[model samples]
Target chain A: MDIIIKDLCKSYGENTVLDSLNAVIGKGKITCLMGPSGEGKTTLMNILMGIEKADSGAVENMPQNKSAVFQEDRLCESFSAFTNVKIANDSLADDTIISHLEQVGLGDAVYQQVSTLSGGQKRRVALVRALLAEKDILFLDEPFKGLDEDTKKIVTGYLLNNTADTTVVMVTHDIDEASALGADVLYLKDGKITL
Target chain B: MKNKSKIEKTIAVAAALLLWQLASVIIGEEVLLVSPFKVLVRLSELIFEKEFYSAVAFSFIRITFGFVLAVAVGIIFATAAYRWHWAETMLWPYMSVIKATPVASFIILCLIWLNSSSLPVFISFLMALPIIYTNMLAGFKSTDTKLLQMADIFRFSFKKKLVYIYLPNIKPYFISACSVALGLTWKAGIAAEIIGIPDGSMGEMLYNAKLYLATADLFSWTVTIVCVSILFDKLFMKLINTMFKRLEDL
Candidate 1:
């Protein structure tokens, strides 16, 4: 079933973020949300993920099981990459997590804690976590922010491959990323969908 | 991480000991404070006595038992309180009283209600419980919500979540609580022993020293307690760091 949002409005004190936002997310498709800074892209994702609530809105058919790559890496800093993925799905064997880490160009860092890994490696770990999780829907907020060109291609391909059958909503400022991920772009402006 | 030799540190400590002996000579009285050399001699003498071993064994067993019990109970209550707001609210006043009340008062009260031999154990438990609970509670509260949400989405088992998420988050706090409470247990345990004057215990020795005005004995015993406390702290910290490293490797 497709997710439908109608007449969604949200505000933080005096600042209006989303106003009467209406959109439809087709089931089993990648939708990339594109906006300038402070365009409420993250707020919308948070609302969809049920971490935050919109002030006034109606959302239909949001999947019960959801996963996300939050704005922060959000990986447990003291735990290894394998452990981070295992935290999301412990029934998974060590080899399965290592394979996923291998895909993200983090094969070497898999046995080391997220704290000791470099920035791009940590982001890949978080991405692998959300991708491997058994969720009906996936939300990614700038999930590929820090990777170099080569690593980005590698990880983006892995993300696309894993999320083929799941509905994905990604927030990014980069049009190239939206294009590379083959996501349907929704242009956002001041509290409204402009295109 | 450091390449410095352990022998250098040992030599430095020896130098400090020699300085202490010089100070003892200058003072010309053991009453004020016994030199490190004199304390070592006394400790060696005490070590050879059968009664001293029994005293050490008794004190060690009771205090350790109390510490272990406190850790178990504290973790349970702290986790419960973390999960339920009502439990935390109910425990607030109890923790406050435990933190604010004087250790001596608790020892005296326990002396009246408990067997004299059990007093140190009871006091150690009382002193340790609140520290462990409060620190672990703070650690639990500060755990990353994002990681929890991830675990929820993934349907990780309780055992997996504990090993991966909760353990890593609570580790530093657990180590810190252990360090703080270990010293406190020794201090409070000995204090209780002195008041209750349990036979074949360090407290009894301290009590005897007081009665005979053997200030050197008092100073020597005090030094022993300090040394033991430091040794325990270092060992505990080392054990925890190794565990964390292993977890990181996992």
Candidate 2:
């Protein structure tokens, strides 16, 4: 089911974040939300993911089971990459988890703790966790923030390839990354979206 | 570095024993203070006596029971308090009173209601409860909110959230609370025994030593208590750390 947002309004005290915004996020396709800081991109994602609420609007058909690579790598620091991914979908076999880590070049550190991993490595683990989870919707918030060009391409390809059929709404500043994912782009400006 | 520290600890202990022996000699009165050698001799004799083991075991069992009970109950209540604001508010007064009131007061107060045999258990439980509850609750509160948000989005079960999120975040605080509480329970428990003077207990032995002014017996029993306390602390913490370390591996 596609997520449909209508007349969404959100605010923090006197500061209105999303003032009567609307968007139809297509199902089984990547929607990249691009905008400057302080725009409603993240707020929209939060509302759609049910992490936040819209004061006066309706979000229809928000998937029941969802996963995300948060703006911060929210992986458990003491757990290994394998464990972090397995934590998201523990029913997945260890062999499958190992291969998923292998796809993102985390095979070497699959058993190493997330705390010991570098920033880019941790981000990959977080991305892998999202991809491996048994969820109908995936949210990626600046998911490739720390990776270099080569690793970014590898991880981005790994992400898109594995999560082809899942509805993904990703937030990023990189238009090139948005294009590379072959995502339908939507730009947020002052609580309004430009498709 | 670890080996060097071990050697340094041994040297420090030897120096302390030498200072103790010099202090006994300078005092020059066996009634006032017994030499380390004499205390050691008394300990060896006490080791052979069935009553000594009985007293030690009696006090040890009750005190340990109190500490274990406090830890289990503290964790349960701290979790509930973390979940419900009113539970914390309701418990605040009792926790404050337990923390502020003197252990002697609790022992004396409990004496009127409880059997003298149970005084150590009750006193130790009272003394250790606040430490565990406060520390564990702080740990629960300090758990990363963002991670919890992520967990919610991912639809983690209560058991999964506890194992992956709560356990790791709260471990250091839990260990610290246990470290302090273990020592406190022993101190307060022995004090209760001394006051209550339960039969076939270490408190009775301490009371007898004080009444007869048997300095050797007093010194020997003091050493026994210290050894027992230190050993228990080390062993219990090692076990806790081992379990957490295993979780980290997972």
Candidate 3:
């Protein structure tokens, strides 16, 4: 089922972030939300993911099982990369988690603490954690922000392969990322979705 | 740099000891201030007595038990207060009273209610509770909201959330609380014992030494208490660190 947002509104004191916004996030497809800074792209995602309450809005068909790579890595810094991913879904086999980390070029650092990993490496760990979780929808907030070009290509490929049949709402400023993922591009401007 | 600091600490200790020796010699009265050498000799003699072992064991068990009990109860109370505002409100007055009231007052009041033998245990627990509760509560409040939101999205179970998020976040606070509470508990515990004069206790030994005006024995027992307290503090901290290390590794 698709997630439909109707008349979504959010405000902080006198500043309004999302005002009367409406959009449909398609089920089992990739959707990229793009916007200038402070346009409430993240606010929209947060509302849809039920992390934030909209001032006035209705979000329909919100998935019961959802996963997210938040704007920050939000990982357990003392835990290994493998443990961080494994914690998302304990039912997943050890080998499956190892293979996913290996795909992202983190096989050697799987057992190393996330604090020891570089920014790009931490991002990959967060991405892998979200991808491996048992969820109907995946939310990626600037998931590829810190990756180098070559690593980005590998990570994007891994994301595409894993999310082929999963609903994905990605927030990114890079249009090339949207095009590479073949996502339905939606521009968030003035708290409303366009195109 | 590390070796330099070690040498510095050694020098400071030696200078302090020399000053103590000089003061004792100038005083020249064992009844007033026993020299360090005389105190050491008294300690060596006390160790040969079976009563010394019993007294050490008696005080050690009660004080340590009190501290351990306080830690467990404090953590539980802190977690409760964290989860529920009502719990915090209910506990506020008690914690404040415990923090503000004099230890002697509590000891005297508790003497009217509890057995003398249990006095140290109660007093230590009372003294340590507020420190642990306040520090652990601060820790809980300081947990990252971002990680908690992530845990929610991932639908982490309570057990998983505790191990992966809460425990690690509260570790530094827990260690800190333990460090402060350990010293406070030992001091308060022994003070309680001295007031109550429980049989077969280090406090009773100290009381007897005072009664006989054996200043050397008094100094020796004082040193023993300091040694035991420091030893326990170090071992407990080591255990806590190892436990956290194992948790992180897992």
DockQ scores for all the models shown?
A: 0.61, 0.86, 0.89
TM-score of chain A, all candidates: 0.98, 0.97, 0.98
lDDT of 3 at B109: 97
* Candidate topping TM-score: 2
> Which DockQ-derived CAPRI band holds candidate 3?
high
In candidate 2 the C-alpha lDDT for residue A11 amounts to 92
Best by lDDT: 3
B76-96 per-residue lDDT for model 1 (tens digits): 999999999999999999989
- Residue A71's lDDT within candidate 2 is 88
Give fnat for candidate 3. 0.96
Indicate the residue-level lDDT of A49 in model 1. Answer: 89
In order, the candidates keep a fraction of the true contacts of 0.76, 0.92, 0.96
Per-residue alpha-carbon lDDT of model 1 for A1-195, expressed as tens digits? 999999899999999999999999889999988889998999998888887889998899999988889998877787778878877765688888899899888878888867999998889998998887878999999998889999988888898789877999999999999898888888879888888
Compared with the true structure, what per-residue lDDT tens digits does model 3 show for residues B1-119? 99999999999989988998999999998899888889889999999999988999999999999999999999999999999999999999999999999999999998999999999
Error of 3 at A81 (Å): 0.7
Of the candidates numbered 1 and 2, which has the greater lDDT value? 2
User: What iRMS does model 2 reach?
Assistant: 0.9
Number of the candidate with higher lDDT, 2 or 3: 3
lDDT of 2 at B87: 98
